[model samples]
Target: MCVEKTPWEQVIDFHGHTCPEIALGYRVAQIAMRELGIKPTPSAELKVTAQTHSCALDAFQVLNHATYGRGALIVEEQGQHNYMFEYTGTTVRVFITINPEILDHLVIPKDLSSRREVQNATLEAIQFLLSSEESMFCSIQKE
Candidate 1:
């Protein structure tokens, strides 16, 4: 006898893949950095996991657009996993993962190529995201 599979099962099975999510995430990060006037780092992390599967692409795109016209290295670090987005050089490494509990952080190198300009742009982006209602994910409040 043949058995039928549920729709949820099918959907889950489709989402179970990781390649697509990672690729899209990387692309979104690249576009966002470019728009912000910062060069994208050659290395980046792109992975598909339960926590990052749902809106990985959307998050990347939104963050990129929201930060457009500004400058900052969007470093998404979830736990030990890290993704660095640079604005003026190639990335040194790229690590992909499917683990939850990973965190994301933005780091502005002390000696960035364009220190003054990049700092100003980074500040602007941070302020804008912090103030916007849609910045829930982008803002990291100090405890």
Candidate 2:
């Protein structure tokens, strides 16, 4: 028999890399869905607004099927990692904020242009971010 990977596992595969933001995006999407009492699916009802065009947005698209092409995801280049998810047909919106303090603790290499080096550093940082617990690095609220 064959086994299928979970949505998040598939997200990591599709993203070709893992980082704290990706994990945070996945968690944020879940929190939003839970708030709306909706099941996870590639539906057109959920809307995602991201403040940056980073791996987190990709994770949101892959895991939750919220993307620009479907008119459900919007990206604003604010250089921040804050995310907001709103379900259509309702006024509910869930905002997720990533703590800058957590990023301050990470040691980013100077040569960010090197793909291999950056990926390695990102993987390591993601591991630490995951173990540190969500409350330390992010906060989610429904509005």
Candidate 3:
């Protein structure tokens, strides 16, 4: 029997491997969906603007269907983990800014030379991003 993949599994497959940035993106995408209400109409469009570039963008592509190729996704480098999601059918746009404190906490120590240690650190960070309370890791505003 063919089984369906969970959104997280699909995102990991699209992004190649699991990492903190992808987890961050996954959370951002999920929040955007909640704020905007899934695809409201058949013709509604989703436009995404990312404040900084990272593997997280891939999550938007996979989960939100906001792809760069179709010009639905854009990056304005402000060196921030901020994201904006605009749905054509909605009057309000959602803006999410990841908490800087959380980002700081997730940083891996540079001195760890062991590959297993690096992987463990990365996984721990990913788990935090995936499970933390929305308010704990980011702030959401609709405008």
Candidate 4:
């Protein structure tokens, strides 16, 4: 019985591992979809502009079908967790900026190099990202 993977599982597999940034990307992608009231399709695709190059972008690639090869994803690397999403053939655009304070709380234990400890910390951070309220983690602007 071959079963298909969930969207989240696909994202993790593509990203090579589970991490907080991927979780953040997942949440941001969901918010973008909700705010814009649309999903990316072959004809109506999404153009995503990412402020930082991180694991989170993988989520957009999986969920929004926005890929760099197709010119649907752009990364400017501004060192912040900001994302702008626009659907093709539409005037609506959504901007999401992640709150720094929320990121501050997700600090990984740098002193502990133990693989188990690091994995645990990353899992905890991913959990926090997944559970946080949209308003608490990011500010959304529509244009």
Clashes of 4: 0
Ordered list by lDDT, greatest first: 3, 4, 2, 1
Go through the candidates in order and give each one's C-alpha lDDT: 0.36, 0.74, 0.90, 0.87
Q: What is the per-residue lDDT of model 2 for residues 53-141, given as tens digits with 9 covering 90 to 100?
A: 77667777886678778888898889887888876766777888878887653556776888888887877776776666768867878
Question: What TM-score does structure 1 among the candidates reach?
Answer: 0.21
Residue-wise lDDT of candidate 3 within 1-143, one digit each (tens)?
99999999999998998888889999899989999886778998899999999999999999999999989999999999999999876777899999987887457788989999999999889888888887899999999
Best by the lDDT measure: 3
Give the per-residue lDDT of model 4 (tens digit) for 1-143.
Answer: 99999989989898898888889898898888889884556588899999999888999998888998999999998888889999898888999999988777456868977999998888888888989887788999999
* TM-score of model number 3: 0.94
In angstroms, give how far residue 18 of model 2 lies from its true place.
3.2
Error of 4 at 96 (Å): 0.5
Candidate 4's displacement at residue 97, Å, is 0.7
Using all chains and alpha carbons, the TM-scores for the candidates as numbered come to 0.21, 0.77, 0.94, 0.91
Q: Number of the top candidate by TM-score?
A: 3
Decide which is better by lDDT, 2 or 3. 3
Question: Which 10-residue span in candidate 2 carries the lowest summed lDDT?
Answer: 35-44
Off by over 4 Å in 3: none
Off by over 4 Å in 1: 1-31, 38-83, 90-132, 140-143
